[model samples]
Target: MDCLPLHTLQTVFGFHAFRPFQEEIINRLMAGDDSFVLMPTGGGKSLCYQIPALHRHGVAIVVSPLISLMKDQVDALRENGVAAAAYNSSLGERDSRQLLARLHAGELDLLYVAPERLMNDSFLERLREIPVALFAIDEAHCVSQWGHDFRPEYVALGRLRGIFPGIPLIALTATADHQTRNDIMERLGLADAQVYITGFDRPNIRYTVMEKRKPFQQLQEFLGTRPDEAGIVYALSRKRVEEVASKLRELGIEAAPYHAGLADRERSRVQEAFLRDDIRVVVATVAFGMGIDKPNVRFVVHYDLPKNIESYYQETGRAGRDGLPAEALLLFGYGDIPISRSLIESGTNPEQVRIELHKLSAMIGFAEAGSCRRGALLGYFGQRLEEPCGNCDLCLDPPDSFDATEEARKALSCVYRVGQRFGAGHVIDVLRGSKNERIRQLGHDRLSTYGIGAHLAAEAWGSIIRQLIHRGYLQQDLANFSVLKLTPSALPLLRGEERLVLAKPRIKVAEAKKEPRRRGTVLNMEYNEDLFQSLRALRKRLADEQNVPPYVIFSDATLAEMAALRPLDSEALLKVNGVGVQKLGRYGAAFLEVIRQD
Candidate 1:
């Protein structure tokens, strides 16, 4: 039962410390206790298992939902000098046998497996023979029938406890409400397990819920400021993923497409490039999560609304993993909802579809909400926040409030004047008094309020429609592709029957433009970028020459400090993080000379 402090292990993993609730969970599991970890993505749940797995004696059996995720964790573990392997579909019989031999021979510390493989009679017999330390279930939320991502296999995973009665089990998921959490415990036969619930708020990620007007334009506007930052653009379909990736590439971004449709090699290449920071953005579907481990991702944009806040939180949580400031910009509209509904409904039973759709609609309401996106997000997870996060679109937009009853009445009148058959676009055109040929031919220009409301712009009418829907004055017809319909609430505005004060478009916060080429500053990049590369080579060479790991010479953290500050002396390098007097004497002069040559 000997152990190192959690903080010490965090530093060994190249991190400063555990995130909130991470240490508590780690201590629980490290004490040989069963626990359920309900943590959001980017919430440091990995460390909860990883840290304890390293400190524990026997090999940790990690039950992952996907082979991709298994490979990712194994690769990351090996990267940090830990022996880990996975027996899955990706491996041939030889590899699987080799991995099993290693595990049984006590040569490996961690092993990941798909649930079906673990359920096999032969696999279970083999696992029983091995000295299993702790049983870890990743994506534990999938066990719940109420969860959106219910996998029957996950439910079967609970039988593991019955099979291996003495093995301590730890279930983990990034996106689960209390009900799902409870379901996971009950289903996994760990109802009395220590429950660790981390707060769902990610303040580092700026929550943005924009009206889905010209989603491409919205995407471009956001990227205009952050062209160089790495990000993920989540779409609902493979076609949309390809289309958005193509469009972003056309816009001169280093973008790529990812989904189950792409070849495994191509997906692997793109994933590698994204991890290496070679690509700036990845346009993908929900298939892109779980396996992703890269930190320092600056943004995550969702072109289509996610089906639930759980999905939304997990996807957005991918950004800002390094505790740095990032943005979660999700573009959504009423049209995206039914597409999700129909997809799930057509494939599943009627009752289950109904329940899933209801959850989706509630999530959409949050997207269209004018209040704090963070507050709405936390509230959905059953966690209460005391204040609106000032970083979201609603907080930033701070729209102007006025009596929209008269305008709403005029807008609905304008829609009615045009026969109530047209969509929001055509209706907005008429409300803003546009003189297109369709308007002229339809003769809606003759309406009393048509030219009278000429002061409003089309975007303004768009804002009005968004607010109308948000206020429940307008309903989107799900039977159609979200055709705007005047609800009973709209009747007050239509006849000036009741008063309603609503905000206008908030002040546009002009974001700084992206300068990929370093517009204002000019320097010899060979000396700048190449110099940093050369320093890395020197650091590695010095480390090898001294017979120690590179960090033992000076960490990458110190190397970066030397590059950024271009420290030319030993004393200067000492000021860098991780640089100490002992190592300063060992390798400082060599690095200083590398920079001095510049």
Candidate 2:
């Protein structure tokens, strides 16, 4: 094997070793073979294509979905001393002409473009005239109809394989289930490509789902612990996004709102501010995070429930991208279910609606999961954990359990006595013996099961019903108004042949005490907090002067390592991780000065 890739990794990108399958994927690309990569969010997926772009004979064409994503990747590459540029609508006509000239002159290492532009007839004709090294499709899951964020424009990317049969192509994504994975390959015409799944576990992020009581208060309490850290709070609607941003700002938290309804310039300004650490929090709809590349986000809070597991996973994966400890707090509420169902059912495509409802049911199951949260999440993606992940809320503070066999039988029987046609709310009303008009009109009050559960509160019964649905004793037919139905598994439980135990309903979010720090990476050694902050101040000054994001100069992980090791000179500083030759030549002296003074 050629050693140039490894050499480039060390001197250019400043990495010591390959992350898991990175080296193998790069080798295959260099050998002119197509590949598919399914790695988690922070799993170094970019390097798998980036290093190959540097070594290939011609400019590598990267098909990106968002202009912001293209710009971030190009900026980071240029900071690492690579000749990269993005051809997007944001560029002026003169800049676009210059970029094309450079592309034709072979003066560029990588060229990033959107899928629509790349598939244009003129762009295809122009590419035919140049020496193209390889093509990379980022956010590849968008090509699949089954993916959470599908785009019809991405389906046109399949033509690239036929147009450039000789040049290698690679497609990559952070989230794809079994069906989405196969659909991506089939849609992208990468059926013969090498597939690499590097697992779906993000152990550094602690998962917690609160009961959504006093939601804004729960959010305030959660944010109180980490007042200075940067994070994103995702809401399902623009109105809610604005409301949350206003409320947070009223409490003196530096925050801003972002949604599609905002003006383009305003959205850009807010994004730029957040990237530069000028804003501590961004409360936004789902439209805000797909293009962000910031790495120091310490937490991600779902102010409202997401629509499906894919959306939830992708949103939460935004935190802890730097391999540091982070948190994902989800405010799970029963009210969010009807809102989400209505949104999913409004679509005209019947098949699409069915798929989305199935996904929604899975999301509800995950939220109501009694076992390890990590186990339930991974299990949805077809991976099983032999033991429980000890980092989630359930693992940290176990929920109180009780013998719920009697309650389970009661809830299941209520579903049956109602002819298994009513939804959870109506079923709960009958169980609690409500004198509502619907109960009286349907004559459900005459049934024996009507007043059997009157002694228990409606909230208690809601918890039991949700648990039954999650445990496979009940299923929801989302297409038919989310009516309750009994599965074969309910028969045994209804016959009293087996007993059940479940977690008691929790109303308030538990405050987790700070844990002792663990050794993360090899360079995650003990560091002085004061010195780290000093170095961070210096980094911010330099970043502001250069008009680039602070992480573009050096990530927080690098600063922590420098503070821990206390490198005194250029030679010593060069020994630190993430200190590439280009960066050492640029910012090494300034960082070393701060360390020496300390």
- lDDT tens digits, residue span 1-598, model 1: 3547544453345444456777888777878889988876667677788877877878888888887678667765654556788889888889878888898898877889888888889989987787887889988888997675788988778788898878788998878865677778899999779888877777778887666878898898888977557799999999999999999889899999999999999997887677655688999989887647665577899999898777888888889764556788877777877798778788557767666675676576566555456766775665656665777766765554676676777777776677657667778877777889998897888877576566888767766675665555665443243356676666756665678776655433222232243211112112255665677678657645644334334433345456667777766666654454445555568778888997
lDDT for predicted candidate 1 compared with the true structure:
0.72
Pairs that collide in candidate 1 are 400-503, 400-504, 409-493, 409-494
The parts of candidate 2 lying over 4 Å away from their true place are 1-3, 401-524
Cα lDDT of all candidates, in order? 0.72, 0.87
Question: TM per model?
Answer: 0.71, 0.84
Q: After superposition, how far is residue 163 of candidate 1 from its true place, in Å?
A: 1.5
lDDT of 2 by residue, 234-301 (tens): 99999999999999999999999999999999999999999899999999998888857888898999
